[model samples]
Target: MKKTAFIFPGQGSQYIGMGKDFYDTYACSKEMIDLAGKVSGIDMYHLLFEENQELDITKYTQIAMLADELAVLKAVEEKGFSSTVNAGLSLGEYAALVASGVMTPEDAFKIVVKRGAYMQEAVPTGGAMTAVMGLDNETIEKICQETEGIVSVANYNCPGQTVITGEEGAVSAAADALKAAGAKRCVPLKVSGPFHSDMLKEAGLKLEKELEQVEIHDIQTPYITNVTADYVTNKNEIRGLLKDQISSSVRWQQTIERMIDDGVEVFIEIGPKKSLCGFMKKINKEVSAYHVDKIEDLDVLVKELSGQE
Candidate 1:
């Protein structure tokens, strides 16, 4: 039997007009965006369609990314396609929750709004994140330790690609050290703050309080967690894990490995970009992967899911 996993993309996947085609074609997509706008007090369509690339701040980026991913998911659902397992990276995790029926779309929108605001305010001092390639995790960890002043590994993206985040100076020094240690590249990411690090602890704390007011239910489908790199089904544990995910390193590599170990053979990335598909390929080339970010892609995916391709 073939098993499939649905994964969602995080912040960096957002583009100027992501999901616009779906938004224009599907009434549900427009209604979802409208509801999100009402709850978030953000003109989501404008932010996603009109904002300048440089103006897409982290605060706005989170909401837009969530909305776009959800829009794509809705389209997929309307076509009667489903998956056996699901997971997401960073902000994409919230989308996963929505997909799994663990969180309502409205609640997901509200939480992401608060999450983005808190994350922005939490690191008011402004920080930086960098992706180091061609380096093993141990080498990256050593470089993080060698650099002074609060630098730490934020995301273990893959075997040879890890992202470090922290105070700007510390991150810069760490990047230089990683290069000296023979890293292929240490490129600074265009993000507003140091995410998934201790720097976001304050944001995590604030989010915990907000989380209490939101409703959480058991996942309808098996879902992987970034904090634990394992499957979580209990509602309480899932809620707690989501809170901790704010400031914890995203164990993406571990999560993917665990999914594969559990028998996921086909991974479909449902979102605005193919970022997760790319990552999944790197994680396991034997497992087939596909992405549905355009109308034609969705049509093709529907066919593939129906065994018509």
Candidate 2:
């Protein structure tokens, strides 16, 4: 097969009724969705399909997004599709673990439910995140360092866009500094917490203890870690890496660059939306990128990759 990588999206990309089409079309998708609910005890189907306000809540959104990604992945795998490697943005990393065969679907669902809750509990008030667009990374870093507060870079999303998170006042001050430094725009993100900042170290510590209770299998396929932007080789490091990833900056731009440097020509975004694909365009437009959400999309992907392979 051509060197290909399967990419998944994180939160803020989810919407209600995301994977219903897959659930209704594929037996495996239905089983996978039900399995998430059975393991997590979250009534996932009702939350994803029926009217529920919990879909936007942090605790529920994480699990719901994972289930939808896994459901779509199940159908894609059923079609005999596979990737040389896999990666996910943030919460989507759980689905990448399942797809890479380092974690079982059952354990993923169980761990994710707890992960979501832990993160929710750790969400401190008066925290904020802002997207600094059309600015270079060095300038953003300099401004963040100059700012006096808990502010720091949260996510290195793409070439021209970076997200900073910290105390609300600090973030606001940093936004002003970034704009003064010639940034095109500094847009505030509507998120519950200052994710990917040191503020969530408590959540990571809580998850570490919880992770010890679960089982990690031998890796069948390698995937990139957002914290380090490198491929995970040993199963033992998973616990610590995941623990630190909670509070560390998400090196998404570096992760994509590493994959491209390693000759991963095709990237497939499997999830609720085309967010990852959007990022891919900014990273390397010459590399082919595809998204698979519906059954029709899978069909298109198969036809598209057939000749490439």
Candidate 3:
């Protein structure tokens, strides 16, 4: 039997007017948008459909991205397509929970609102992140350990791409060391803070308290967690994993590999950009990857995945 996976992208994939097509074309999408507004208390239409700096900010980015992703996913599911497995990167995990039936979309929206605010408010001074290209994770990890200050790997994105985060000085020093160690490029990320680093542990603790207020139900489909890069079998582990995910390295590379190893042949990236699709090509060439950010993209997906269903 063939299996399909719904992979969602995180923060950097956001853009203005992301789910406009879906919102206009599908009642499900419109309901999602309205529900997000009711739960998040943000002007959903203005925040996502119009240009604004806050859309890129952490506090607003998480919910906006989630709303957009959920709208897209709902539109896809309405077309009679579904997935065997699911996974998301960083902030995208909340959407995964919603897709898997582990949490209601309304509850997820509420949690994300607080999650985003907590992360934004917890940004440490002088914190930074940098992408290390063309370097192995082992080498980058070793260098980050050797570098002074609170530097550490933030994301294991792909085979040759890893993101390191920490205090600005530490990240800069680590980038220099990584470059000298033969990294092809050490690009500084335009981010608000050292997300996924130990510096954000306080934020994780705060998120844990928020998680306690929500109810988690049994999952309908297995989803890979970024923190463990493994399948979440028991719903009991979801909350802790989400909490730890705040200050933990997003094991995206490992998560995708685990899904592929488990026989996921079709990966549909349901977000604004082809970020996860791009990563899929780098991670593995054998599996088919598609993106459904716009309504027109669904035409191609229908043609390609018609046989799979």
TM-scores for every predicted model: 0.95, 0.98, 0.98
lDDT of 1 at 81: 77
**How are the candidates ranked when ordered by lDDT, highest leading?**
3, 2, 1
Please report how far candidate 2 places residue 87 from its true position, in Å.
0.6
Residue 151 of candidate 3: its Cα lDDT? Answer: 97
lDDT of model 3 at position 56: 90
- Name every residue pair that clashes in candidate 3: none
Q: How well does model 3 score by local distance difference test?
A: 0.92
Runs with alpha carbons beyond 4 Å of true place in candidate 2:
307-309
Score candidate 1 by lDDT.
Answer: 0.86
lDDT by residue (1-309, candidate 3, tens digit) is 469999889998889999999999999999998899999889999999988889999999999999999999999999888999999999988899899999999999999999999999999899999999999998999999999899999999988899999999999999999899999999999999999999999998999998999999998998889999998999888999999999999999999999999889999999898999888889999999999999989878887777543
Residues forming the 10-long window of minimal summed lDDT in candidate 3? 300-309
Full-model lDDT for every candidate: 0.86, 0.92, 0.92
What's the count of clashing pairs in each model shown? 0, 0, 0
| Cα lDDT tens digits for candidate 1, 125-159 | 75899999999999898879878898998998877
RMSD (Å) of each candidate, 1 decimal: 1.5, 1.4, 1.3
